[model samples]
Target: MSTSTSSTTPLLSLRGINKSFGAVHVLKGVDLDVWPGKVTALVGDNGAGKSTLIKGIAGIYSFDSGSYSFEGQQVEVTNPKQANALGIEVVYQDLALCDNLDVVQNLYLGREATSGVILDETTMERKATETLKGLSVRTLKSVRMKVSSLSGGQRQTVAIARAVLWNSKLVILDEPTAALGVAQTEQVLQLVRRLADAGLAVILISHNMNDVIRVADNVAALYLGQMAAQVPSESLSHGQIVELITAGRSGDLGLKAPDKEVVA
Candidate 1:
């Protein structure tokens, strides 16, 4: 793991964030901080509100109550366009790349440049090449390779490259290495670390403990709709994080222990 210094002020911050759908509360008083130039791993078990929280951040769902701040200013993000306007981009688990398009086409799917009613292919290809090179990507043999011919890791790289092409300040990756092989997983993890090192705030959501410990500077564990703990990765061991995810409390690091019921 490379040691990269984080900014003193968080690029994104949430306080007492709560969300609900009808009567079911999905997120409760969750607090999180994401600093620039560092990776914060969002880890939890199944149905631990990880998806809800990330959706709220991505503006796919609105929080019922809480303070949402970015770059030291309070803001309201209730839609995807608003989130994009604020320089927040999310690369969802599905990747959403087109199998029929090549790398350049996929990278500029919706936001292609044009000049006088004609597409600027040269500009698009040049920008795509620059973006991939800026990220130090070297696995792809050619920028014109079709998506159907690319491997899982290469597809992930294209999705990530698309996210950062718009000068985004923060990037949220959802289960990026879920079905990748060992070597591919390592490649994706290194790409994630590079995003942060390039001065972009990153929120990595994953269920894998080893991946969390390997590249995350901090770990934020969610347990049953509540934030169990958000601490430095080096401060907690693998067992402690597992306990927090499973039990919502690990010694004194998480929620306070429930009071014992009297036997009267």
Candidate 2:
């Protein structure tokens, strides 16, 4: 739970990012930094602009204004392809796997290896097996099994492994444990920690406070489309995180709190 990135430059930094839909403003001067080898949890209530912020990063929608810097260099990511080209991968809430497809098929769905106009099934299967093995994933019975027969945790693992197999620098997981049971959630959370341990920046978007507190190194709360605060998870209590999510700041944060309120 102790995530210290001292003396290390952030791998991804967003400065004053603004997004709007016609007359509706979604993000307002949002600023955030993601360090390699750490997990930054993005939490917010419904309509707090968490989704909008992530979409902008995912290149689903272009931000009306603001700056995006990856590895301290300014860049424009106009589409998911651009994001992927920059070593950014987003594993959405749905997991987006073809249920009927086997593990190797899902892993190499679109980017399968080919040999003289023929699908290289042997190579793809070997790569899939190696990828899972590299992640230290041992619970899977077989990488050739159809996704439909895998448990929720195994599916999540496969999705994450696929992202990592591409040499991704940053992996954004949206609600990874949302539909999973307790043990399954624990399994996915362990993989999340392993991701950071392997030196990849991880942005975990989840509404579950317990999971966030348990796995996140740093927690960034989004309030009304703005970044309320980004602090070490160990420095915040569950109630304080909820307070920031709901009110943009913790009301009980005496001297540490901002001085916007005057004591009568």
Candidate 3:
């Protein structure tokens, strides 16, 4: 994957974030930073609060307590619309495209361009074509093809392209390569790299360690609800990442043992 030094300023920064459901607290003082032109992988075991945290960031659920800042400006995100208006876009694992709709139609599903009182197919198609081109995506045969007929990789590309078409600054992809074959997975991964290369802050949520290591610039491990560490991907081996996820710390981050071992 192509890489650049992490920027001094993060495109999105969350400090001391918290979330809960009734009596259950899911997130505990989580801190994360996503820099432009880089992919930050969010990894944790099941029920480790990864999903809950992203939902809070996507504005599907409001964080109980935290400071959310975008490009250095503090702000509050209470709803999905607000997040979108602020250039935050999330493409979930489901790929939420209408099977019956073609790429062009799916791309402009709710927010179609209109001229006077008629749907402007020409302009919308042009925009979709340009967006895909801008991302250097060329896997689709035609933009008019039905989504159901596209391959897994092609479908993933369409969802990402749709998000980018809306002038998104931050793109959150949830398990983007899940259920894809090796070749398809590679195609999608390349697209992901291009997203960051194009200068968009990409938050990648994946369980595949190889994929994360290959494409991510940084990895943030969450054990339970707390951040175990947010370190450079190149600095960690797979074992170290696993240790952090399971034990909450590894290497120097882990607590030191006493000089003497206790006998049972």
TM-score per candidate, in order? Answer: 0.98, 0.93, 0.95
What is the Cα-based lDDT of residue 238 in candidate 3? 91
Instruction: Write down the lDDT that model 3 would get.
Output: 0.91
* Tens-digit lDDT string for candidate 1 (1-264): 557676899999999999999999999999999999989999889999999999999899999999999999999999999999999999999999999999999999999999989999999999999999999999998899999999999999999999999999999999999999999999999999999999999999988999999999999999999999999999989999999999998988998888999999
Most accurate candidate by lDDT:
1
Ranked by lDDT from best down, the candidates are 1, 3, 2
Ranking by TM-score: 1, 3, 2
In model 1, the Cα lDDT at residue 62 comes to: 95
- Residue 86 in model 2: shift from native, Å? 0.5
Model 2: residue 247 alpha-carbon error in angstroms: 0.8
lDDT by residue (tens digit), candidate 2, 35-88: 899999999999989889888888898988889999889999989998999899
User: Candidate 2 has which clashing residue pairs, if any?
Assistant: none
The whole-model lDDT of each prediction reads 0.94, 0.89, 0.91
Query: Across residues 1-264, which tens digit of lDDT does each residue of candidate 3 receive?
Result: 665554679999999999989999899899999999999999999988999999988899999998999989999999999999989999999989999999999999999999999999999999999998888888888889999899999999999998999999999999999999999999999999999988899999999998999899999999889888999898999999888888888978632333696799
